[model samples]
Target: MPTAAGHRAITTASMLTAEGGLELRPRLSEIPAHVGVIMDGNGRWAASRGLPRIEGHRRGLEALRETVRAAIDFGLDYLTVYSFSMENWNRPIEEVTDLMGLLKRFIRNDLKDLHKAGVKVRVIGARDNLKPDIRALLVEAEDMTRANTGLTLIVAFNYGSRQEIAAAARALAEDVLAGRVKASDIDETLLAQRLDTAGLPDPDLIIRTSGEQRLSNFLMWQAAYSEFVFLPMHWPDFDRRAFASALHVFSERERRFGGVTARGQADKVKS
Candidate 1:
């Protein structure tokens, strides 16, 4: 990442406004290294509009496509999305099938384009019960885009935070039982290494759409200090403006990571 003062002037193709007018934008500073999104409100959006739920999901895909491009243009290094979860299986079978179809379509249609744009796709989740074809598609996407060096998109499918932690603990327990590692040697870093997102940096910001304020069991361990931005718009309605607004707010915040700033310490003393 370059210094905050170093914004290269590029073509205005990606800086178009909602009205399609070109605009010169300042270079972004204080960009978060990793961002996580909880995509919500597809079903509610469809219900309110008296449309099939699938329509909202389809539109959400478009939003995701635009967001990926925006993240690239905005200089974000890593983006993680809560695509699907283990709890999602409890929904209607028809909806689950539709969701799975959408997932398949997204990979088949978008993988080539993403690879061309230098994006690497990584799926983090349990693969035990997925259909063989779904598993194959995921593996294909990862293998195909593994060598790219641009933005890393992490898709959390069939994932649950508690389950993720338990799996890591289980793996560590097995190692200890086998005498490969001692129980006393375990620590935060060692536990993190046993998780699926071992090599990836923790999220700097987490945004949830549809006005949700809770984490909904996503990235429990990885989001310890991540700043959160909850939006009233549905997932399908999230656009570049929304993304930029979140980043702007993030830039103004002072992240002390459980400590106080010099100003804060001075105020404390004065008080």
Candidate 2:
């Protein structure tokens, strides 16, 4: 074994080496390459402050912008945020209308900015559920940012993981009926490739703000072994520091993938 001074010298040399070319910041080990965020607490945030829920939604959108930027800065590849859900339609029609309007406005304002920032924006859900104008805008925004390569910002609109899975099932059934594929060959990989996030990687982390511990129908099929971080703070209040803290938590754990370990690794496990 090397002596203490000799080990220090080797460590110093490794840090000084340009073997990995160059990086602006020290490498962050175990950073979540794919992060799923359940953007919650807009209504509660508004009610807590005696503000309109629409205002809360508005603030939430701005916060999402910051989140997108933060994820890019942290070198996250896929950032999926639950923007709208099928259950959200149960809310008041006026509030729903405003939410749809907010969606349109976000598309109009941020689509260009996202494209410019090299972020790929994708709307994952049933486009047919939206109004004509909103659908058109969603289509336009999706097309504009489709070719981008930096970050994949998936906005789940009118989305639910159960619905997504059901849709996939229907698709598979159709293919089977048409004699295009065998029913027995329908495995997880085949199903995954048919989902809306076909070409994307599975999420490594699923974060929920507003102290919620539930999945709320967000990526249920994909989050099988994902690491979760819950925050009591609302979505509008969750910032970069919170994101960094989650990364730090993720980095500190060992991801053994259900393997048996020796004496040096019994305290923590992450996936």
Candidate 3:
């Protein structure tokens, strides 16, 4: 775990910044390395079409497939999606069951293609409460794609950011009690290392569909400085074009973190 000085902010080549009124711009290749998405509005999409909610979810899967391919084509290294949340269990039992069935079917039907495409599967969520068969399927997906070197697909199934953070805290506390670590030594980097997304870089950009404007507990900590794009279309309508547009928006913005950029400095001087 590195201190703030040592924790270098992840940077892509050719990024634009405001410096002394000079336009500092990034190159076309300076795309985000990691992207997170809140796959929303599936039920709404289906309802509008006079179809079952499950149909929308099924269509959403198709959109997800396209997004995966698009991400790879765009040269992104990682993509995390909110597949399911712990709160989703509050839905009717039938809806929950349908979602679980969809999850099982998707993995069984798509795992081979994902492996063939060299995608690495990573599941980030609670597993103990899941049905045995579903848990087994998730494990199988991860094992089959473990060795692949291409895009890493993180599925946040049965996940909740607050729960994840609490779990990390508990783990750290246990470590302290066992004399494996000192409470005084805990820091952002150390705590992050204990998160489900330990090895992965924080998302540079997060996109939510159906015009939503909220985190919904998805990657709450990891998105501290992430740029967000809210799309009007539902998850099922997301496509390569929409993805490209989001990237374009990301490219046009400046990521200043906590400091004033050169442009800001210039503006202050002029004022």
- The best candidate in terms of TM-score: 1
> Which regions of candidate 3 fall more than 4 Å away from where they truly are?
1-28, 266-271
By TM-score, is 2 or 3 better? 3
Candidate 1 to truth, TM: 0.91
Tens digits of per-residue lDDT, candidate 2, 1-271, equal 1111111101101132256532222143325668899999998999999999999999998899888888887777789999989999999999999998888888888888899999988889887767799889988988988889888888888998899999999999999999998999999998987788898777777889999899998999888767788899988887766776666555544444456444234344431
Question: Please, what is the TM-score per model?
Answer: 0.91, 0.85, 0.88
Task: Give Cα-based local distance difference scores for all models.
Answer: 0.87, 0.79, 0.87
- Order of the predicted models by TM-score, top scorer first: 1, 3, 2
TM-score of candidate 3 relative to the true fold: 0.88
lDDT, candidate 1, 138-194, per-residue tens: 999999999999999999999999999999999999999999999999999999998
The collision pairs in model 2 are none
Query: In angstroms, how far off is 192's CA in candidate 2?
Result: 1.2
**CA lDDT for candidate 3:** 0.87
TM for candidate 2 is 0.85
User: lDDT tens digits, residues 1-271, model 3?
Assistant: 1112212223233333345332322233546788899999999999999999999999999999999988887777899999999999998898899999889888989999999999999999999999899999999999999999999999999999999999999999999999999999999988999899999989988999999899999999999988899999999999876887787777667677888877778889999
